[model samples]
Target: MDTSIFTDKTIVPEDQDLIRELKETSVLWYAIRNHVHGLYPDAMDEWHYSGVKYGWSFRIKDKKRVIVYLLPREGFFKTAFVFGQKATDVVMESTIAPSIKELLKSAKVYAEGRGIRIDILDSSLVDDVKQLIEVKLKN
Candidate 1:
């Protein structure tokens, strides 16, 4: 995660029009919402809840879905982190873990761009996640 993506102060939604398309393309979106409640108890009540950054926040829809941040924090927003849905506990363990990893990768880039590092006050569970992360850089 490069700390140079969050230099811009003007970040808009990735693609409002594409949102409908994404929802339509991703059929499991609804299921994710239905199952997310147990994952994030207070997410539905508030989406952009403050955590470490204070400058940025997270947005959760339904219970199973999370739209943490959009853009790479640089170059007018480069990427986004959107989680899909989970079925059973085993599936959740398999899927959600990767989603979180992706989200964190995006966040890391955002934070690095802002010249800040992520400090977890209580990160007792970060190690439990199991997900393969991928990042592509332009030449």
Candidate 2:
């Protein structure tokens, strides 16, 4: 998995607490996947975000799915930059936003604890993904 984006910077694995946060992110991500279809029945394929540590954007069934790209950027740890699919009118007012909100909340807490700042790419409109991202970041 050519992790060139992450290799440009150094990440100390010795941060046990950050390690724990990564583990937790994995677990919560799994749960989010399981709930994807139910949340957004029209989600689509997964797309990787550039210039992020672990940034990836994908669709569950049709709606967009966004996750934290835990990578170090210019000496700052960046997290939760929205890289998911665009949100459509159908998805903007749907339950997908709330569901994604919950997922991001967990991710934000985990990333923030590790001294990371979260941001959203906001390229997807099918899921109001940008708004979801901003909500989490602001909160």
Candidate 3:
């Protein structure tokens, strides 16, 4: 169990042992972790919405605007993004994977926003997730 991999402590659970085990199980998880922490080192904010889910805030100032939520599962994880109305159009225009593009189109837009979930089952998907995040962040 180690705390060194943590970038935002607010969302991370107290069970360091569990986090360490999850990190060891999935390499894709590590890639996502590195990208999130490395992309916004100082300004990164996190909130654990529930026992097994945590969201990341890619905010402008301190408004607590969460862009993505990461949910860890068996040997993989899903990154969920709730894009605003404007961003949804941009996402439709972006050059993301065909599957993900469909996900974006069909995601329900509610009181919060349009939500889409991308499962990080392989390292190859990291770039797509990052691209989607960039679009969501801009929104």
Q: Which candidate is the best by lDDT?
A: 3
1 or 3, greater by lDDT:
3
Give lDDT: candidate 3, residue 38: 65
Error of 2 at 29 (Å): 1.1
What root-mean-square deviation over C-alphas does model 1 reach? 13.5
Q: For candidate 2, report its TM-score.
A: 0.29
Give the lDDT ranking, best first. 3, 2, 1
Give a tens-digit lDDT track for model 2, residues 27-90.
3333334444344444443434444554333323232233333432222223334422232222
Q: List pairs with backbone clashes in candidate 3.
A: none
* Model 1 weakest 10-residue run by lDDT: 130-139
Q: How well is each residue in 1-139 modelled by candidate 1, as lDDT tens digits?
A: 4332223234422334224434432222233333344444454523232333432332444445432232223222222233222112232344434544444444433322311122222222222221211111100
Question: What lDDT is reached at residue 92 by model 3?
Answer: 80
Per-model TM-score, in order, reads 0.25, 0.29, 0.70
lDDT of 3: 0.61
Candidate 2: where are CA atoms >4 Å away?
A: 1-21, 52-139
- The model with the greater TM-score, 1 or 2, is 2
| Model 3 agreement with the true structure over 4-74: per-residue lDDT tens digits | 23344454544353355456445665556566656566445444433212332122222466656666554
Model 2: residue 39 alpha-carbon error in angstroms: 1.6
